[model samples]
Target: MATDHQQCPVAVIGAGVMGTAIATTVLGSGLPVVLLDVGQAELDRAERTIEIQLRHARMMDALPSGRAPGRLVTTTSSSALAGARAVVEAVVEHEATKVGVLTDVAGIVDADTPLISNTSGIPIDTLADPLPRPQQLIGTHFMNPAYLIDLVEVIRGRRTDEATVTAVTELLAALNRRAVVVRDSPGFVTSRLLHPMLNDAARLVDEDVATAEDVDRLMVGCLGHRTGPLRTADLIGLDNLVDSLAALYERTGEQRYRPCEQLLAKVHDGHLGQKSGRGFYDYREALS
Candidate 1:
């Protein structure tokens, strides 16, 4: 028999780029989703974003056919999360903000409901610290463009039990995503290794070593990489990259993790990559 909570919608907290993408992925799997944010404007934008992404996915033959997409409910009320089957937190990468959101989510959802954090690099155990049911809290680091990414990094906290891990991994499988389970650590596997290289790529552009185009072309042409590091940074958003790099540097005290000056400058200028219409490359025409 399915429990009442099991039949309820998955709750996604935050309505930013990653949040909307996650909601779209869940909806693509035919699961209703409640997308919550503190502001109505953000939620409205998220709704539009999800609609467009869903259409694109369908056109690309990326979504499952013959099944109507799941219903999406946008809300500003935290109480709406009470009976969520699972809660995914996709707020800003700052530790304090995530802790505050997870702490509140922990109280609203059922005791058995899994608390999934879509944190890029922050440690899962650190985010679980504020929650009463720490064992239910885990990290599901969905890459940028979550709906299209086929692999997800699953981080298990120190107290995360076997059942929690199983539940999350199974959920990923249902969404047509492979889960690569990794031990809890700041930056985990992907971010820790990827960010340093991205930062160096930015350094090359900043020092006039090569034009962004030349650098990317060399990487793609010579290394056979699908996308160059700088272009990947643009897709990931310079602001997000800076935040993740800062978090890693603060947590590990590693010099390599320090965000390069070029990234900081780009973020300060509000040139946030593809979403902002400009970054290393001009996306205004593409976005328009």
Candidate 2:
């Protein structure tokens, strides 16, 4: 039997860009999903956002070999999460915030219902500690714009069971995501490798090595990066990046993990990214 045929509905909390993308991708694979948010307003906004993205995806499908997917639903109640087999928490990155949400949501589901985090830098070992079934807790870090990215790092915490990891990988395969199993580390391999590199790029800008645009262009054109760190930061949202930086710094105690001064200033100034419409570049008018 097909995995989708036997698969239970997926519950995605947070309904942010990444959450909705994951939900959308899963729904495309014929799996139903319930996107839950803490507030009704947020739930409504996310539902609309998913609809817009669905339309764009359908347009892409209409191109020569089209295959647009059907839509999914959203909810604001924990009660709606009753029958979900897997819950992906894409909530705020604060440790306390995550633990609180997961702890609460974990109580309302079966012990077999896997609890996954959409977190990127936070350690799975730390986040899984307070959940109901720690063995069933894992990290499923989807790249930004999850609908567009192919990589989904499936991280196994100290208490996470092999079976839990296996089930998540199987589900990702169904959604057409490339899932990579990595050990539960402070920052994990990807974040450890990436933050240092992005930090170096930020240092270049802080030290006046090149303008932000020039540094970004050089990296993409010369270094063969699809998207340079500076621009990537803009898209990732500086606040989110800063949070990751703090987590990595505290975990590794590495000076390189310390976010650049200029970067910190931008974040403090509220020039977060495309969401705020300004960061390393000016976009006050365009965004307004």
Q: Relative to the true structure, how large is the alpha-carbon lDDT of every model?
A: 0.91, 0.79
- Write out the backbone clash pairs for model 2: 61-66
lDDT, residue 199, model 1: 94
State model 2's lDDT: 0.79
Q: Candidate 1 on 16-52: residue-level lDDT in tens?
A: 9899999999999898999999999999999999999
What is the Cα-based lDDT of residue 9 in candidate 2?
A: 82
TM of each candidate vs. truth: 0.97, 0.90
**Which residue pairs of candidate 1 clash?**
none
Give lDDT tens digits, candidate 2, residues 194-252. 87787788789889989889988998999898888888888777788788888889888
